[model samples]
Structure formats: C-alpha cells, structure tokens
Target: MSKLKVQWADQHEFHALLRRSEVEDKPVLLDLHSPECSGCVNHDRNIYSDPDIARDVMEYTFPVRVVTTDPDRASTDIINNHIYIWSPTIQLLAPDQTRHHEWNGAPRRTRLSVGYQTVFHDTPGHLTPDAFKAQFLVARGKAALRNKKYGKAIGLFDEAITRHPDDRVTVEEVSRWRKVAQDGGVIESTWDHQHQVTTSPLAAAVERFAQTVATLPDNVLMQDWIGKPGTGDWQWYSDCLREVVLQAYQELCNFAVTAERERARHGPRFNDTHRLLGQHRFAYREFQSLFIGVPDALLDQTPLRSERSIRENLAHMVMAEWWAYRPQILHALDRGRKGLPPQVVPATDTVAQHGEPPGSHESLHELLALYERLHLRNTQDFSGITDNELGIRSAWWELGPVELRFRLERYIWHPRDHAVSIDKILDASGHRHTANHRFAARLFSGLETAEAALIGTDGFLAGRVDSLMTTINERADEAARLLSQVTDIKPGIG
Candidate 1:
C-alpha cells in the first residue's frame, strides 16, 4: 500500500482542475489548510497518508490542496464562497464547482507525548480514515445524483451503507439520498411520482423563475457591480437586469408550453428525456406560428447580406438534424446498448455537403412539411432513451463535444433559432404581432419593471424582495394561463 501523494495548486490551476473534472466526469476534492495550523499538518501526515484512504480518494475524486494563508498558493474565492473560519477544511465539489459537502477542523484523534508516556487526544473535527471514506462516498453519490446518474448514485450509496454501517451520520444521509435516486430523482412533488406539481399560481411562477435563474451562465451571474446605484459601475447591474428580464420572458414562454403539455392527451412521463422531447413538439408549434401571414416570396429573399434566405435556413435546419444530429444520437444509443461508457465521437460535417442554397422551386409549405417529418422520425429514434444514456457525448461542430441531452435541446432550439431570424425578416417587411404576442409583451414589460426595481435595490431588503417576487409570480401565472389559451390559434397568410 502506498501513501497518498499531495498535489498542491494555486487559484489559476484550481480553475483548470475544475475543467478537467468536467471532462473526466469526476468531482473535485478540495483540501484547504494553513501553514501555522498543527491539525492541518497532522492531516497531511496522518489521515491522508493512510493507504486505504488515499486509494479511495484517488478513485473517487480529483484531489487538490490549497494553503489558505498563502495568496500565491490559495484560492481566496473558495475560502470566501464557503466562509470558512477553521484551519483545515475539506470540501467535495461537483464538476460545475458547486459545493456538495464540506467539513472543517482536523481529525478527532491526535498523538500526544506526556513525559515518558504517549497518549492520544480528541480534536475538534472528526477525520478518522473510516469516517473520511464514508464522507467521500456520500459526497460522490450526491454529485452523481445531481448529474442524473441515478443507477451509479444508488450503487455508491449502497456501498457506503455496507462499508460504513457504524458511521451513523453518513449512513443516515446515504439512506435519504438513496430513496431520492430510487424514486427516479424527482423529489419536488408528492402528488405525482414522476411530475412536479406546483400547488399554486405563485408556486408555478416562482418555480419557473428559479429554473430560469439556474440556466444563467456564471459570467452573467458573477459580474462585479461595485459602487452605489446610478454610479459608473451601476451599468453592470443594469446590463444584468436586462439579461434577466429577457431570460424570464423566454422561460415564461417555456412555462406556458409546459402547462399545455400537462393538459395534452399524451403528456410527458416524469423523466428529463421525455420532457425534452415533448418540449421539442411545443417548440415546433411555436416555430410554425412565426410563419403566419408571411408570403412565400419573402422566404426566398435574404433578410441581410451574407445571410441565408428563410427557405435556405429552414432546409439547413432539417438536413442538419437528419445528417448530423440524428446520426450522433443513433451512435450514442448503440453504444448505450453495448453497455459502454459514453465517449466523444467525431463530428459529422453536414454543412460541407449541404451548403448550397435551396432552389426557388421549393415552396415554404414543402419545407415546413419536411421539417415536421424529420421531427417525427427523430422522436421515434429517441423513443426508449434513458436518462443515463443521455449522458453519452458526441462531437458538435460549434460546441466541440456535447451530451445527448444538449443535442435534444439543439433539436428543439435550432428551428427556434432560425425562426428568430425569420421573425426579424418579417418585422423588416412590416409584419404585425398577433394578439397573443402583444399580450405576452405587455406582461413582460410589467414583470421587467418589478425585476429592475428588485435589481436596483440590491436585495438589501429581503422582505421587500420577497414581496416583489410574489408579485412577479402572480403575473407569470397569468401570462401562462393566457398564453396556453391562444396556443391553437392559426392565422392564414393573406
């Protein structure tokens, strides 16, 4: 048995390690220590050095050490984010760098010398090798659960129970989390085992708001808004506020679509894959609405210089799915059937072969029909895809490597992306907004006012912010109800 090797890293290397963790599909084990702390020294020399403990850590996580006292060697962001006061802290972080579990201080036991006698004493933190192993197992299991690796999560939880039955604290946590995994990882509502039930109108909107907030990238969320309101730096806050409102509008549209799904004859089952597929159908419906009152002649004319005409963009959307995305999904499904772990495969170059403009002979109606057919075929291909199988990665021309879930999302959004461009063309040609679109815009304008006020206040008054969120939620629910009613309205092109 060999002792654990310590790999110390600075803040810059910590970011690289996080990227490495994502690519390798593993959590990061962060060990923070101070130079003057004896417990920190003992942890390095005693607990981590143990062979069994070292092996378990190495197998489950990407371990990195940081010295909290040294600016050159430490990650101040980690310290500030976690708000640690203890000398030695251990944190288990997911691939996205969100903390899963953390514990502070040092091992519970320490060797002591009293004259001629050697004794052992209890410390502030419990860091025995057995306890530490249980912690790693439970933390890793939670990370797996978050990543939607339900089977693997349950297996890890069971192993934690079987191996460390006497570790009561860890065992209790694993037992609770194992049930969550067993229940297909849907823990939001008790009414349905598969679907989350929003108990009230307020609850539904709040839920949508939370979901939308989660999708914002770290760069947007982590912007530095230094100084007071109306100052030079206040523009950062204003920019962030605008982005939030735009995202909220998009999410409200999605929320309304989902509400329609619940009322449909064949609703999505309580799983990510099915829900995504259902959303694709809703997206197609939304995309179809964009063409209302548009002339066929408009489809052949390019909206901007160096841009494809609406007809060409529609053709590319259909062909990309058939030639590029569909093949990757099939390859991933095949690998899943063969019981192999997901790997990055080469990208299909659909653009290279199908780069030519669509002929003027093709009508808008024909292109729409072709797209619908492709959607149905792709849906059939993804009929039995499991959540675990969705993790399979394939190469994307723009995104490098992406998961099946992302591909499914692209399947939904690719048409929507083109639809946005088409909408621009329609606007330039003096097309008017429908009643539903106009109503949604009014609701969004009201919601944007509330959101901007909340952002300007800097959330200092938590109670006031809570009240404003309630107002936003009520407005969101109203928007959802109104949008769902107009979903079936179809206007003819005159």
Candidate 2:
C-alpha cells in the first residue's frame, strides 16, 4: 500500500498562519467549510482530492481546515447560522481573519452585466500549485489594501487582472470591492448586500405590482371594493394574486422564521422565493390590464359593502391568515389562563361559508373593524411566541414536530395568492380573468418552483420580517389612498 500523504494545518498553527498573513502582508488559503455541505462535499471530491491539486496547493499558501461543527450541543449556533445561509463560502483573509476577496454566489455574468461594478461570484476550480499561487497572490493583494499597501497589493491584483485579461471580471468590480474592504478594514463582498436586498424575494414582486397598479381609480373592476362580492377565477386569473404576492411572501418568511427561530433564517436563500415573486408578477399583470383604459362599465364598481369588492376580500384575507395561526396563538394564550378561546373561528355568514360574495352589504368602517380584530389576533399570537417553541420540537402536530411558522405563513400567503385573482375579476368581468388563466398558471408554476428552491435550503426567514412588514404597511396605505381619490368621482352605478 502506498503510504498516505496528507498535508494538514493544526488548529493553532492554522490560526497563526492566518494571523501572520495579516501582519506580514502575506496571502493565505483559508477554506471555511463544513463536512456535511453537499456543495462542499462536491468541491472536496472533485477538486481537493485531485493529486495534482494537492501537490500544487502547497506552492500557493498554507492550507488550513477550520471544522465548523458543534458536537457539544448537537444543534446550530451563530457561526453555523452563517454557514447555513452561505455554504461553502471561500474567503481570502489577511492571516488575521480579515476577509479580503470572497466569492459570492452571484451569477457572474448577470452581476457584471449590471451598470454598477459588482463583486461577481467565482466558482474557482481547484487548480495546480502554480495556478493556485497566481490566484492567491491576486486575492491576497486585494486583502492587503487595508494597511495602505496599495501598490504592493496592486501588483498581485494586477497580475490576476492580466491572467484573465479578456475575462468579464471588470476593474470597476475589483476596485469597488477593494474599497469596501478598505473602508471596513475587512471586505464583505457587495454580493452580501445584493443577497440581503433580494432576501425577501417578494419585494421584487411588490415593486413590480406597485408599478403596475400605481394609477388605478377606486377598483380595477371600476367598482367600489366595499360593496361587491369578491369573486373571479383567481386561480385562472393573473399569475400573482395581489394580496398574497407580498402577503404570501411575508407568510413564507414568517414560516421559515417561526419554524427555525431557534436557528437563523436567511432571507429565502434559494430560488423558491424568487419563483414566488414571479407568480406575484402575474397578479400585477392582471391588475394592470383592468385599468389600462378604465372601461366605462367597470367604473361603477364601488367599494361599498359589496360581496366582490377588493376591500372585503383583502379584509377577509387578513382574517383567513389570522385563523390559520389561531390554534397556536390560543395555545400560547391558554398557557397562562385556566380557560382559553376556541382554536377554530370559522365565519358563519352564508356568503363566507361559500366564499365571500360579489356585492356590497357593509360600510367600510364596519369591514375595517373586523379587519382590525384579525390584525390584533395575528400580532398577539406572534408576540407571545416562545424560545421553547423555537428551539425544541413542536407539539403542534403528531405526524412529526412540523414547523408551525411555515404553516402559519401559508395562511398569510394563501389569501394574497387568491387576492390577485379577485382583484382581476373586480376590474374586469369573466372575460379578462378567463383570457389570462393560462398565463397565470404558467406564472404560478414558476412561483411554486421558486418557493421550493428558496425554502428547501438551510436558509432562514425571521431575518426578513422588518422589511416585509414595512412593505405591507406601505401597500395598505396605497390601497387606502386609491379609494380616497375615487370618492370624488360620481358613482358610476352600472
């Protein structure tokens, strides 16, 4: 048997090497990865195991392995949290653990194509020692800029820039990233900012929706939302159901957050979140179609307490979402009281039982009053959530300790998903809604795929609540403002 030849850096020695790189202005190869990562496993199997790569690795820099596991607790922690969202992340640290150039998960081509210089993600193939040295010099040079060693670092970086002279990686991209590192004394690639912004996944849909519906008068159906019975083949309507475009996304984030609260939730770390936004886009598309020319017949549809009014449907959506989490909320409430409210609060209205109607029956004030109660219920339940619930196995179900947060979020999003359809039906008759069904289906399918991609990973959701919640509040204001603008127009009772 050929004697096994393995080069390993001891823990203390590894740290020392990293520290030296920082002080001495040297570059080091620091691989921060986990054994369990599928991506990491692939990289190891395909690249690290290569004999040529092993031989060549020695020439570039010190190769150290930092094991990021928690055997003592058998659970995830802060650093693990980082790994969960940003798996197999490669960082060029200044021996001192100061990050220099990091390969973000950005689609290199898409990132570079944008106007601003972006630190594009690089999937570096395991290279021979010589090649490794070349890249290391460049990466290390970038890390060295913090100590006012611009010229020295430039030499390394410039070589790298030359090696890939015809490559798409731009000078602006490298310069901008270098500046970020210098300012912070350790560079966190701009890719992090992009990921953070794209975290919600739903925000993109909302932004697009806002752009689509910015000029609607009263209702898209040209009727007052307060009076119509809310109905339209929403499933067959636009791809994005307006209410759920963001609401569903909010639910998705909340679900991931609540399910993994004890852990961290990376904002839709996968593509599933993006797909959800894509479905939402269809809903906005339908909204745009209804008001493009403001059909005279549809203008009469008022917000009066009608079965079909969007206001009622949105209000109902609020309650539906509230009801979904009611059991858990009540369970929390009952923990302190001798007796608690009922878990399931189904609506008794005949119209509600068969799904809300399309005509008006209640005043806006009365409907809002109902919505207020639902909102109150939702907030109370969330605020009362506990660490025990977050950290331990849930007792909410028997099949398995299911993630309660994800379930609760489904309810939040379901209404919004359907809301898009209802809004379309309100704006036009069955005609527009029917014509757009196929498009909606295609988009909805895209959303499901996106949700699965994003939600399937170890990414977290709780982290995105603030921005998402802010958007909902803003949409509510916008919707309210649209109604006010229409109050002055003569009611076109068709």
Candidate 3:
C-alpha cells in the first residue's frame, strides 16, 4: 500500500485551516498523535499507510495532524472536552468547529499503588483499517445530522453499521446516533444543573454593568476620559471612572460572547502577553503572504505617493517593534517590579536613526528571518511580564506618558498598520499572486486604546471575570447547601 498523500497541518496552521474548512463546507479530520505511543505508531502503519482509506479521508475532510509533544498546543481544548490527553485520539469536527464524533484509540496509563503493589490497565486497541473507515462514516453522519440532513445522516449511519458490523464499538455509537437522527437529531445536554447555576452569575454581573452604564451622565460619556490624570478639569476622577467602567463592561460582554470560540482557537490560558504575541504572529503571517511571490525588484521600488517601499515598510516595522516598542514596555515592567518611579526619556527615532538595517534589502527570506529573530527575542523577554505591571506608566514619544498596557496594544497594531501599507504597495505594483488566498484580517480598529485603558485599571478583567463569577456562584451554593444540612431544633426538642 502507498503512504497517505494528504496535506498535514500542525497547531500553527490550524486556525487558517479552520477558516478554509468553514468556507469550503468540509469537516475537519483531526488526528491527535504522539510519536512515543505504540497505538499511534500502529495507526500510522496500518491505517494511514493504506492508499484507499487515505483517498477516502482526503475526499471528505480537511485532515490535520496535531502532535502531542508540545504541551502548549496539546493541552488546548480543540473541541468541547476533547483535549489531547491521550495519543491516537481522532476527532471529526463540523464546519462550525464543533465536535461531531471522537474516538480514543488507547487509554492513558497511570501507575496505581494498592497495598505496596502497582497495577496498570489498558483500554481498547487501535482500530483496524476497515473499522477506522467506518468511524469516518459515522463522523460524516454526525456532521450531516448537525446540518439537519436527517435522511442523509440516517443512511450514512446505516452504511457504517452494515459495512463494518464486526466493529462493535463503532456500531454501538452509530446505532445510538442513528436513532437520534431518526428522531429529528436533537443532541442531548452534557452539562448538569450545577453547571447552569454556576454560570448564571456572570450573566447577572454583565446585566448589572449594563444598568450602571445607563445611569451615567450623558456628558460624562461624551468626555475624553482617556487623557492623563491631573491634566483634566474638576470631577475628572469621577468622569474617567465612568468611562473606564463602561469600557470594561463592554469589553467583558464582548469577551463573554466570543470566549468559547477564542479558547477553541488559541487555548484557554491566554494572557495579555499571549494575546499580543498572537496578534503579532497573525500580522507577520499576513505580511508573509503579501510578500510571498513579489519580485525582488519591487522590494526597493517605492510605490506612487508613498514615501517608503514594501521592503522599507517591513524593515521599519521589525526595527521599531524590537528597538522602540519592546524596550519601552520591558523597561516599564522592570521599573514597576523594582518599585522605582516612572522614568521620563526621549523616544528613539527608529525610522531616521535606524534607516533600513542590514539584510533588509537582501532577499525576502533573509528579511523575514531577521524579523523572526527579533520577534523571538521579544517573546522571550516579555514572557514573564504579568498583568499587574501593565499599569506602570512610561513617557513615550509624542504620545506623552502612557501605561505599559497602551504600549502593548500599540505593538499589536503597529505591524498591522505597516502590513496594510505594504499591501497597498503590492496593489499599486500589480503583484496579486497570493491575493485570492487572503482571508479577512482581524482588526482592533480604535478599540485598542480603550481596551488598554481597561487593562491598566484592572489588569485585563475580561480573562478572569467568567471564572471569578463561577467561583463566587459555587461558593454561594456550597454555603446554601451547608446551611440546609444544619438541623434547626426547638428549645426543648431535638
């Protein structure tokens, strides 16, 4: 049998692939594997190596291979409760990125000590090629059910059951889901009443915030409350507080609405630093796409009405990101951690002073390599900086004194701004080789400054608010339960 001829993607390319899947209306076949796992090895040898099975998979799904070696990527919730905790875990996701079906080939092992002896147990073995193909059919059936194609879904499930009747595990699963399709495909709720109760506090808190915003003075809402304190007029503190609260509330709601989708895409442990880094990476990816097939001659050739060429624009972004913005935030963090006062300094001019650093005018590959090095250094340096340090103010060029959080938001948008300029340059020069491949770029627009303000006030409340509310609700419930358990007796009776 020939080896599989399908394109494989890792976590880095997963988001783009998801977008493609959505646009193409195809399910995603996700293979969570580990090199060290025997079951994974067996699957590779027996299942993926078969040409017929590989062709069938490629024809129906967008296949992605996620390696379990990287903890950061593997620990993420790719689908609901479908984290990569074990090797050879296969999942098929609908176009909306919801889990349609999943199969864990082997059980995760842990040594259990009982009376000075250790014992281990294993679950089912890897699927045979025929069984594996049956599982794919079941996955397709689930996706069809989700799309309300009841007849199609029932037929698919029946086919899987008929074609691989010996695959007991898959047959049982498909049988249950087939009946579900027969009954109009209603997915049962997996969450309990406790989950519902615990999550209500977040919605209540959000509503309270909305009501509070409604009570604020109309004039206060219109004022420029983001200005540096002590520079504004009387009642400045109160007005700024109103604006801050409103922005925080808005950010909180926005975050709540998209929290699950964002977590599914970028993991659940995202901090301010991670968010900034993700945005930077996204911008660089876009930049790479724009410059991929452009001729070497166009790199140095400035576009009409534009002062800088595509190469110059990219070079400036890389230089400024590393030299100017990174240093400002890192210095502020250092000072804040050391309990030293904010320092005032003239900002270094990256454009006039640096001019195009060496290797920028070389090949596009070299320039990107240079930028990647700088980005890596920045990532390493800023990895340990916490949300608490974001409020530390530093005097920045022209913008005057601003919080480190503001600097971070600026860092995210800076490369994107340059990327837009470079895109225009490419447009002007008619280098649209990769134009059709571009997806809609996510933009912060003008919300970055407002969001930074919220961060400076409360250390990025949006990330923690949901969990905080859940904890509060859980505690309250526990207290109520305890009180109910305490028997109340009359003075003379028990």
Candidate 4:
C-alpha cells in the first residue's frame, strides 16, 4: 500500500472545482468537517485515511475538503443553507450542486428531492481496504440513482455487485437500489436530522421564563415571607409587581371562573379545585396581616371566611389583588421613600367582613368592577415609588421580619401555584390546558426575571434562573409539540 498525496480545496478553489466539475459532467465529493468535532476526527483517522479510499478519491472524483469552522463565509453559508448537514458529512454532488448523496455514521440515502430512490445498505465497521472500495462503489451508485441517471446508476450497481459478489447483503442492496431507481415514483430513504432540534425564538423565550418561575416559591405563606426575606436592589421587583402581578392574578381569576363553569357542568370533580382556591384566599389574608394593622392604607384586608363559591372566590381574589397586596406594597414604598418604618395597618373588622356574597352574575360583575376601581386607586397611589424602597421590612410577624422583595416573591408564587391548580382542574375536566400552563409559566418567568434583576449577582434569585429557564424550555417545547399536532395526525415521521 502506497501513500497518496491528497489535495484539499480551499473555499475559492472548491467553488472553482465545482464549476469545472459541472462543465465536465463530473461528481464532486465534499468532506464537510468541524475542527472541534470528535466524530470528524475519527472519520479522518478511520475512514478517509484508508489507502484504497484515498486512491479512489484521487482517481474518480473531484474531492473538496470544507472545514466548516473556517472563517470563510461561503463555506459556512453552504453548510447552513444547503446541506443542513452535521459535522463529518461526506456528500457527493452532481455538477449542478444538486445534492446526490451524503453519508455519516453508516450512512443511508435519505430524501433530498422527488424522483430519486435507493435501498438501505448495511456497512459494517472494521472493513478491509478492498471492502471500503466496494462500499464506495455502492455509495456512488446510490448517488447516481439520486441524480436520476438511471442507466449510469444501474451500471454502477452492476459493477458494485460484481465487486462484492460474495456478500449477499451488498449484492441484494445493489439490486434493490437499481430496482427502485427503475420504478421511481417518489423519492424514498430512511434518514433524519434527529441530532438537531433547532430551538425557535418562541421556544427560547418560553424556556427563559420557565426557568425564572422555577426559582420562585410555588406558594409562600405569611410566615415564610416574614421568616427569610432576602435583600437586594428592590426596583425591578417594584416595577414587575406593579405591572405583571396584577395581570397574573387577573388571569388566574379568569381561569378560576372557567373552572367553576366546568364544575357546574360535571358536578363534583372540581370540588377539590374550588376548595384549594378558597384555602389560597384564606392563606393570603393571613399573609396580609403581616404588613398591615389598623389606621394605614386599606390595601391589606383579610377575608372573614374562605371562599365558598366561584363568585365568592372571584370576589375575594379581586379584593386581595387590589385592597390587600397592592396596598401593602404601596404602603411599603411610601414609608421607605419618607424614611419611615414599614407601617402596620389593619382594616376595620367591618371592612374585613364586607366581602360580597357569591352565586350570581350580578355579584361577579360587581366584584370585577370593584377590582377595577381598586386597581385604578392603587396604581395612582403607588405611581411615585422607586426601586430605592425595596429593602424596607415589615413589622415582625409570626415568622420574623420580611422585606418587600420577599413579599413580592410570595405574592407572585402564591397565586401562581393556585393558578396551576386551576389548570390541573381544567385538564381533568378534559379541556386544553396548554394555555393555562403557558400563561402561568410566562407570568412566573416575568416575575422571576424582574426579581433577579433587582437582586443582582449574589441574590438567590440569580442562582435559580438557569434551572428555571431549563424548565421553561422543556415546557415550551412540550407546548409547541402539542400545538403542532393535527386533528387526525399520523403517529410517525412526516
């Protein structure tokens, strides 16, 4: 076995060769490799370096070695746009740049265009140089078949059959490839780009959002908020809570209404769901008690009882959103700006018990209106707040003293967890739950991102963002998959 000096074409030279090959009616072999790719390394050492393989390449085809990692724009563009090929792809092209064939990892011909056909071949590892040559002939035959040069392809297959006459599998594969080319209706091959699942922008954003949500607590009680409120810059949380927290609460309230309708239709399945909603309402009221006492803004009001109906739940939720949480947050800002301590303000018992009775469209409408009114008032009241007030701590409660950051975290997470529960209820009721998941996921993401921005580098919020983003990505990926399904979609590869 003698060594052959192989010429590798640079980008310009490769294109010049391609042009010449087109005019001469010759096939061009492209060895597309990535410098850092381990598979590419193995391919060079194990397959391309074989003495017989090198001899045939020099004699039979115009070989172009394209290192994709090269800074050459043309080479990178070709890899990106035409081949969609991964590293170590060995492709043979017709004179016209029509991709005739490509192989990597025991390659089989797959669909590139219509009218081409080929049979699968089994190329075992540890091939002798002659066996490698025989496989190359089969590869060439398939490439011809792909180019629709049926006569040339048949002749090539015949030659391959003669070369590997002792190997029944190779002979049968050649015969099959020829037969398919003869009866070509539509192109057929068994190959896919499973190694690459490109993430869309929507998928990426969703992922980032999920990761943010994953870091925040699913539900936070007053005790937890008071016990271990972490500190950092407070501006982002103030901004995010002012904007998104209200919207998230509203969406969850809407979802709860839908769940109620589902319960009505089915009867008892949503009982647990409604019960959970009621408990969350009650828990938040207790949470409100941590930051408010009598004689302050009436933002932190406690419900007299747990919600008992859909209408009651909605009413309480809206009330909590506006009067309790919003007021408490705004009050903290006011005191912080004034350089005063966090005021402990509680609503009068009369005001606390003033929840609207449930079980009517009228009550629901009134509650919604009240929510709007409260929103307008609180938004106006808290308009002057800046991030500087973020580190303000509430008076000592059941657990300990809690800051505005922890309060915002609990606010976002607590309702978010309930919203998730509502989604589960909707799913069990046989409804599309992707919307619910997407909403909660996005809400949590936004809140977490805001919180993380506030806390900066050393904040606990920062640590959780990466993992939360991974979770969001997984969720968004799943949502995309489910959404892409056709009504009567088939099970396998399209």
The top-ranked prediction according to TM-score is: 1
How do the predictions measure up, each by TM-score?
Answer: 0.35, 0.31, 0.34, 0.33
Cα lDDT tens digits for candidate 2, 1-494: 75222265644565578666656555555555455544455556655666655655555456665544322221122123223112224445454343444433211110112221122222222233343334444565655555567666666666666765543333433454344444543332211101111123453343223322332332343333332122243233223234323343444344444544433453423233233333433332333223222222232233322123343354444434443245443453454243332232222222123332221223333333344455434443454344333322223323344343444445346645655646665645533433222222333333333333333333344345454445444543454454356554332211
Candidate 4 lDDT over residue span 287-361, tens digit each: 221111111111111122111222323444554555456656766666777788776444322124442222112
For 1-494, candidate 3 gives per-residue lDDT tens digits of: 74567667776776677788878878888876667656677878878888887888889888887665433533344421343211226777655544566553332321122311111222234467887788778878878876789999899989998898988666666766787689885443211111111112453332223222222333334444433332134234424534344334344445544543445565444467656655554555455445433445466544454144665566566656765676667766777788887663322233234332332213444565567677756765765667677778865443346787777777778777887788778888776642112210111111222222222122334546556444324423432343234355111110
- Comparing 1 and 4 by TM-score, which wins? 1
Order the numbered candidates by TM-score, best leading.
Answer: 1, 3, 4, 2
Model 2: residues with Cα > 4 Å off, grouped in runs: 1-6, 33-60, 67-84, 104-137, 166-172, 175-494
Candidate models: Cα lDDT each: 0.54, 0.39, 0.53, 0.43
Model 1 lDDT on a 0 to 1 scale: 0.54
Q: Give the per-residue lDDT of model 1 (tens digit) for 329-352.
A: 777678767877554333213323
Query: Model 3 reaches what TM-score against the true structure?
Result: 0.34
- Score residue 207 of candidate 1 by CA lDDT: 38
> Between the candidate structures 1 and 3, which one is better when assessed by TM-score?
1
Count of residue pairs whose backbone atoms collide, per candidate: 0, 70, 0, 13
